[model samples]
Target: MKRQQLALFIGLSLSALSATTLSTTALASQASDPQTVFSQAYQSYLAAVKADENVQQTAKLAYTSGKAVYGKSDDNTANLAINYAKAIKGYGDELNEQRFALYNEAHTILAANHGKQSIETIDALLGQANYTTSAYKAANFLEQVIDIAKTQNKPKFVADMKLEAASLLAKKFSSKKYREAKNYLEEADEYYQENLPENSLERIKADFLMASFAEGRKKYNQAIERLNRIVNVFDSNLNFDHSAELSAHSKLIGLYEKQGKSEEATKHCLAIAKMVPWKESQEQTPLYRVNPDYPLNKAKQGRSGSVAMEFEVDTAGFVKNVSILNSDGGVSFEKSAIKAVEQWRYAPKFEKGQPVSATSQVRLDFKINR
Candidate 1:
């Protein structure tokens, strides 16, 4: 019995030792070393950040310094240094140095791994662009990046990147660089046709930008077509609740007027007129505040009375042929009233879908508040 008990104790001891050894080895294999953990985490972070350039770069630094002594194996340390520094900079963190170094490394690595002709260099170039301060500098960077990406047949990235480039180009259009900006926008359109959904907002936006650019060049027809798509094709309901819709309507109205479509212009003008609320009043002649352009004697106090005038409103909504049916008193005041009346615009009466000359009477009253 004594021998058997001793043998059992020895067996238990050996089993415990073996179990402890296996546990240590397994832990070591998994993430036993802090260095190994850091290395793995760094690589994971790099891959995770492929699309987000703005990710907190401290992720790399944390991984570099997070390793415990046991994890600080030479192989793990070297690999950690390589990959982390490859995505980041080894030198003390100057924002420019860190940015430029990462870009340089990204370009070099992409060229080596993805082939010299790959557009992956665009990724690096874009990173460099993120650090640029000047609009022109940023545009220049994005242009090159987009060119390379498109050359390497990356349709989606090229398309996405072109949005920023096009905006910059539009801002710089007044300068000699407008053509280059236009070319960048054209390239963006090509990408949108391939990658974006038909009738997508992005595609619509691209069309809108091009249209505005055309309009800036006084290409009215092209601008009208683009504006029409936003109203007719994209937003068929003509919802005017938002500022964008209002702006679109305004553009369409201007285009109509420019193209001599007076009828259409009148329709829009009436729509705008309807938005302004009218106050019901019992006064025969409502008090009219003179527009600053009206030549009124500053020293003279306003005299109150009504002057009834007959006017002809033309097809273009212009008031013409003003004649006073009844005058209150002064000739100077009457003349001033008639002159301002001639320049007044009216909502022309419509007959058979055309604005016709209509006779109307307006009573003008001048009142000044003390």
Candidate 2:
């Protein structure tokens, strides 16, 4: 077997079928069973992922032939539907409707075959939750999975479900859903703290969600504490930059700023500015951005305007020498834009691997209901 194909077979628990010598192209011609053809095409689809090749046709073949062989309620058909849905998602955003249809089909088949609360059904629902754009639908699916998981001896699965539920529920941001999200976060955090490594990604994700929930509820101190712990874990355990670390620092910064702790916020702003790549190496690029608040008077008039500003980023990444190039609104818009830009930080340009001050321009738009 090809090395990548063998790895995929192990992952899919299809080692027995992996021994077959038929290529996907030859499978239909050589084997009378649609099952054999579907299985080979499925393997081909997996191989395509590793090869960074598109095999949507093969994926479709897997689905159609698998359904013919195993029927709709068969576990094999359900699995094929779910995996192909995920694969189709990778093709692009254009297939979103089709992918959702596949997930819905898989969930229905799995529920019929294995009962509503079975692992297969739960997994299919989770897939739908992951792909759905609507927060309400995602939360509904995750809530179902979490409820079902509670009835089984599946602490880890239940915890995972709760964590997902917490993330989506918080997005709803209503009082009831917010409290529900908080409860779910607490449960997920407890399980992760007890069962996973302190520095594990799963634990960190739970902590991050907790931090977000805290921030949303105006509990700044609590949010800061949670984010700081995450920062410490990333620093001491990982000793490297990750997107999660950036996110923690970003949250810490806004929380500190909201609490009137400019010094602390600046510290994180600078820290974040240094973590990512700078502009083209020839231009300064923003790392810490502050959105301009709508001018109260203009907002009252239901007005909207934009101001373009040219600014100098100092060697330390602080904005300076800011000048409003032009504005479509009035002086209020220009002043607000400049105020926000003054607090912004950037990745200063580097020449010969040394930091250099550089000029950058940005247009800040102030609008209500935008």
Candidate 3:
């Protein structure tokens, strides 16, 4: 998982617990020293475990202790319940039915304290989605999150959730689900355009997702357009090593091959080949390279592609004037091709033993089998 996903997961878990609490006089008195309450609950839970008491009984004691701090309507109660549930889940390698039961109990408590459609409830849903055994169930939970985000006027959040939901739906592509996934991607693109900066990573990601969605729908031209937009941004920004850029390039190559644009595809393949380190001078070689992730829709359908590009290696060994010479695929391939070439480094050509700029080309191929 990416760092962003992990952060979002943690945030959602905390938000779910925090937002569900309802204030009451009893809660206020207990909340005066929440730390003490949490500590007592932990100690009791540890003691119960040490004594080898009934696991469910010990879990209940922990839950009760947490509730004493802020009543049943407190975030601390949810947090304690979640912790105990995790402990139970990790207690043994065998399937622990009690763990899910406890998780459901915590979720029910949160929903009862808050409203079913509340952000708190959505958070719990996200947690369930993360831990659930069923992909369909997870997709449904993400859809709910998207709906809640829409109602709250959180366009960025809506886009984020929609992207996640679309990805899930795309993974399980059927005639119906593919259409649904495309719709989600389209909606996410709208939100991204309205709420995010043109060069924002989130917007780039949206474009990547849109390209995939377009390809899945056989809207090759639209997919190309979306990918081209991503490449243009990377070219202007010069942050060519982004994973999205690589994906764009790879998809473009595949799309081109599908269209029988062999010449264009060959160019992209050459452009990728140029990315190999020119080790004539160690200092001139690329320090790092980021490969694009294969398009999920394409992977599912057993598709492949390639891209080619040209650029100038400056005296400083930095790539410059990057351009797609040809691409068999659409904008997706071109974007990634240009992006990678733009980051290429090489020993500057020598004329009379003096460093000088030189022109070069490379190709990249995207393939997968499953």
Candidate 4:
């Protein structure tokens, strides 16, 4: 058999039929000989396909069997139709002509039986979006899903769908579409801000997209800010190996390079390189420095102080083992100093031609800029 047909057969064969609630008479008949009753319809579907019968006829039989076992408005029937359509399209032959019609028919049936705003219908729409050939059409389907979500008062779902649409729009090669993509991203951001926490995965995803938009528009500073926010969020809430943090780091390096800030780019590269063993025949140095923000309260009180911190720069160029050696400032200044220093990325130190951990001390002065 063809590859697509073989795949479809494997998928269908592995799927277990689910029992549906039925009328009393039907239930009694099903209980009497459940397997035989269901198999009769299913086997007929299989026989029709094996005999190279009409594609529609075979799909109809599959749907009939699925409904018999899983109810008219069940996901099973929709899946059967979708699978059949995908298989037909994969054939890339005369049968492919009817694939889209079959898909639309399936979605129409689902929406008719299960209300258009129902979760079942929304799921079917999402499935259709994935299966459709045109990006614009897929985005339209997602927009419809979002509209339904709004009617259902699901802000999170609306945000998720908006992000999906934005992501799709961002993939287009035309720069003209970037504006539209940005609009969608902004809408997604609004919803996310209202519904998700600062460190939530969904919000991070929005930040990533917004950063991309900024980069596309040549707003390097804005892009850098967004990328840094993503990194900070991931570093604070997720493991080191989280994909978003890695992506943010990579993007930051690229953006810094574009801005001709080779030193900044190199710092991030060294940080990532710490993941592997490397040899450097030079002493470590500060590549980037961040000044601590003087607390407003301290400034109003006319307070000026200094904080000294000792930390270790690991092979990956990340600061760790931060200790407060001394602090003339109050707790507010000390906290700000630690937060800024922790975000610092350093150049790797070399000992005997190999990168190794090194300890260092630094003092930060916090004073109100009168």
Please report the candidate that would top lDDT against the real structure.
2
lDDT for each residue of candidate 4 in 12-121, tens digit (9 for 90 to 100): 11011112221111111243244346545555555665675665556566555555665555555565666566445345434544555555766787788777776656
**lDDT of all the models against the reference?**
0.54, 0.71, 0.60, 0.66
RMSD of 2: 6.4
| TM-scores for candidates 1 onward, in order | 0.42, 0.77, 0.50, 0.53
Off by over 4 Å in 2: 1-29, 33-40, 55-58, 90-97, 129-140, 172-176, 239-241, 277-288, 293-305, 327-332, 347-356, 366-370
Instruction: Give the CA lDDT, 0 to 100, for residue 33 in model 3.
Output: 58
Better of 1 and 2 by TM-score: 2
User: Which candidate leads the pack in TM-score?
Assistant: 2
Q: Indicate the residue-level lDDT of 97 in model 3.
A: 45
On residues 1-370, what C-alpha lDDT tens digit does candidate 3 reach at each position?
A: 1111000112431211133321211222233455456445555555665565665456666576656754665555665566566545344324344555555666777678776677766656655655555666666777777877778876677777777667656655444467767787788778778777788766776777777767877988888888878867876876456555555655666676567664554444433334333445333333233466555665566767787767787664557898777666456656755665564444455555455677777677877754
RMSD of 4: 18.5
> Clashing pairs in model 4?
274-316
Residue-level error in angstroms, candidate 2, position 288: 4.1
Give per-residue CA lDDT, model 1, range 237-343, as digits (tens).
Answer: 44323344445556767666666675666555554334333233321121112232223563264555456788786655566788989866456557778877765
lDDT of 4 at 21: 26
Clashing pairs in 2: none
